[model samples]
Target: MAQPSLSMIVEGMIKADSPKPEDGWTLGWDVVVSYSEEEINKNLASRWEKHRDEMIKEIETQMTEERRPGESSDEEDERPTCDIKLELGAPRIQFVSATTSPTVNLLLPVRKGSSKWSDKQKTSILPENSYQICLKNIPLGTVKGNYEEIQDKNRSGKLPNPTTGEGECRFENRVPDHDPSKFEVSWVVLDFSMKEGDLNVQGQMAPGCELDNVEDGKTKVRLARGLKVVKSAAEAFFVGTRETKFSPVFNVLRHALVTVKNKELPQQVGGSRNLTPKKFRMASLKGSEVKPILSLFIHVVDGVDEGESRDLQTRWGGLWLNTKEDVMAPIPSTHTASILIHPKLIYKDVLSRSLASESNKGWRFKQLVGVEGGGIALHAALQCEFRMPSIRLQFDKGSGRIQVTVDDWSKDLKELPATIHLHQRAMDERPVISVNWKFSTETRRTNSRSEKVHPALDVYKEVTGDITRWKTTFKLAQDVPMKTNSTDYDITLEPDMGKLSQCWEITEEEGETDVWDKIKNFFRVAWLSNDEVFKDLVVESKESMRKMIPGFKLGEMGLGFFLTTNLLNPGAKVIRIDKDVGFRAPGNLLLVGHVIQGTDEVKSGKV
Candidate 1:
């Protein structure tokens, strides 16, 4: 299929265990991040060691308070010497595909916290001996289990003698319940929608438990009645964990995406800038049946008028594929994607706005010709007013460069109004001499009745007779070499001043002059054309032209808007840009690049 004039397509695959259905999975999506049992336990152990002292003190204080005033407090004395250990088995996550909900299960073994005190004195307890502490039977509504006591020789208050037997006591570890359903907690169902300029998400609990009863022949387990209450309590736990542990991360991601989509470009007074997805779908490709591919179509529209009518489907018609054959075509293996840009977006939307900005229109200067007493002080003021010029970009496949041509420089270039004044001193307000001149395209004039007097002719009429009419013409054309860099999508076009070819032609019709007078006028024209004199004038003219219309660094011109508005992702850095595809393609400009993900934080704000 042909590429679009303006659009972006991103294609990638998700490796799944089962083959994707032809119709595709459209109910919802699931994302699971898993950690191994050893890794989770290692992290927990480190944290537990750091706060073990504080936790033991808190537990002892609580246990002491729970004892009645008259009850025996002998068991509390051994609590201070007990050692606590926490063990958690690997966790499992279950995602309900139909409802797009999540359920988490964790295994927690119960062990006895304390053992009965023997008749032996407390002083006999060896400092090297360790005791296991068990938490109370908290009555977990979802899972049921019994605490088991540790069997060891130390229970008889006699530490094993190093010379007689093994120096350490042995305690058997309790086996935890492995039934996943007993420890499962289901989260609320969440729904998401993107519309207008906002991302909206809403979550609610299921009306009732779907797995309530087990029916066998004419008998029902009747366990669902109690299970319903337990499920409600689990839902509350899920909500608490989501709010405390996951909501902040989710909010940050949503804010970042929405901010980039709705960001407004600078100097966008009459139009709007928007970044939105055109299409997003999940489907299986030909060779990768088990690996479903995700195709996301995104587009950027900048400086579009508020109420303008735009048919995006027609404008981007070439990007769409209609049949299975076209959709199943082998995707590009390279890690790159193209960005097609229309000419209007560059010339009208970007360059025109930058040139017409108030900050870059005109300049002023003052200089003294000589240092001698009050040597001809000269001051000049110039201003430019111009219409945007038409430009063409031709990509050369061999050189990998774009030939930028400006066919008729005079057509769009307006005359520059320059006013110069001569003063004897810096403090003088009124100048001794003042001249008003205009630099522009050449002209012609004749004394014939049919020909009108040129504006420039009037300026010289006081010195030369009206009968002595003159004609002048200028021809200007330029071809600049533009180099494209893929790194930042920058296009560099700086034309050499010497290569900007121009020609000036001047002729005069001396209507009624004698031989000697005509001879003098001829010498005057010859003097003006001398190589030494003309070279200086041409050099000065080129200098002024450079100031009037400066060269362009289009890379910044295109991306400056996004940077200023904080639209681009802070965590992604452009590593390499690929313009070869664009040069080979039929579009005016195409750009592709690779970006490396960083750990930068995304700032949030309304665009």
Candidate 2:
């Protein structure tokens, strides 16, 4: 036998018309709640019992007190002796499938109760020609009487005498007697529609009951009034702050992403850093118009300019040292490490770029700051630019993976002064003139000098060489498994270094020199002198790129949790999950699984 399957898809856009079951995939949900007719009746009966005395007192206040025919006017008149009973019929719940949204029709029939009137004396209190009074105007249950039988007797001039107690005499003012069991006043009809994450209910009076004096119409109006109160209460609780209609779901998502254990993400993708998500939004996919994709904007961390301070100090300090004839002479240079730092080094800018558009692609960070503290040794600036590719989440059937592509990266050393002082001399001595240089890996350059006289020249060579030799593309893939218990399920992603690899090309500039040989010669000498240091730097750069995988995994897990938890019915238990679970294009996360309905008793068993 095939297992029952359930699929839930949150589309970018929903049609006005509700989807039908025949659409192949049903809305992922399980009915874990039910109410029996007997249970409903019992509850109603208990409510009536609690307020029965108060209701009777209210009815008594509306009734008029009349004395017996033989009683004296001076004597205190006795209150009318009255008794009332209420009964309820079985309730019926009807599911309306043809409506635009999910709708339920609730029907409850009320049975008319018999009433008895009594007097203290055994004698008839009514006069000979007296007629039974109708309390139709009273705000109470409908009254039944034999009006037709009495009218016929009156037409024939044969109305029963009340003093003889032979027959009943109902006045024309009394309500016409119909079937005792068919009282419209006791019936309740309510329509409940589930639309746009809200519950709307409407009360309708029973058929043929239009008068406000009628019991059925009055009850229906009161029920409608009560439902309005309920709707307001529901809105207040669920629509707190109005940030999102489903704030609880978002809260769960935030908790899952922040708390879920993904050790590989911090260690491999980005170093040990806190993942602070600033804001989240949902939007449609670009071009395809697939809607409801979740996007998270993270707080930006300051990118360390370690090379800036170190390189600037070394270059200027070295130039000062090179100009001195004696190596032991104290340098007069005033450049300090702190003053050489780049302005706006801290990255605190908010991420406002759109990730949905293919043209825009990813988040971009760029900054330009004048190189500081070289004094007369150097006058230059640095321009840094990098792009963080958009993270794509895909799931088809059962397998799921999160991916990111990083390619755009460039740094330029601009405004390099053309003259330098190689030797200390008189104040008016002319400085050695050199050709202008734009040292950047992004562009090609030709230098007259063969030897690396300054550290900046070595840096340019190193950057160009590394850019050409290192693998330009890095891709990391890992399996995210759903952990399930009898009552709940969770998704966890751990980075697998074994699955991490790099294989892609970076577009090269035209007419660029092939400097692989020159880089090899330079690295050969450096490797012999500082092999461990070079190895550590390479490891650090690779580790930084690796961190992207874990970060993407964290996002994927958060989205998965948001979708799954929303589909779950309160108190429902996970019975089985199909092996196939993943994301689909056009913006959809599909989960095929089975859940034990909340109404069912769940036993202690493995999921």
- Pick by TM-score: which candidate is best? 1
User: Mind giving the per-residue lDDT tens digits that candidate 1 earns over 48-99?
Assistant: 3332232111111111113557868676454322122222111111111121
Q: Residues 1-607, candidate 2: write the lDDT tens digits.
A: 1111111112210111222211211111110111121222233333333322221110110112346699786966556653322232233333222333222333332222222345433421111111111101111011111101212122232223212111221212323564332211100111121223442223233333322433666554643443332233233332332433543531210001101111222122122222221211111111111111111111112322212122322232232133322221110111000001111211111111111124333323232222111111222122223333322221111121111122344532233221211111211121111112222233222111122336454321122122222323332222222221111232222222132223111232433336775666466444323434333433444454445321111111121122122111111222233333321111111222332222322121110
lDDT of 2 at 93: 33
Kindly report which residue stretches of model 1 are placed more than 4 angstroms away from their true locations once superposed. 1-335, 341-345, 353-471, 481-484, 488-570, 579-588, 594-607
Those runs of model 2 whose alpha carbons end farther than 4 Å from true positions after fitting are: 1-94, 98-102, 107-501, 506-556, 559-569, 574-579, 582-585, 594-607
Worst 10 residues of 1 by lDDT: 23-32
Model 1, C-alpha of 383: deviation from truth (Å)? 9.6
Overlapping backbone residue pairs in candidate 1 total: 3
Distance from true position, residue 540, model 2, in Å?
Answer: 17
TM-score of 2: 0.25
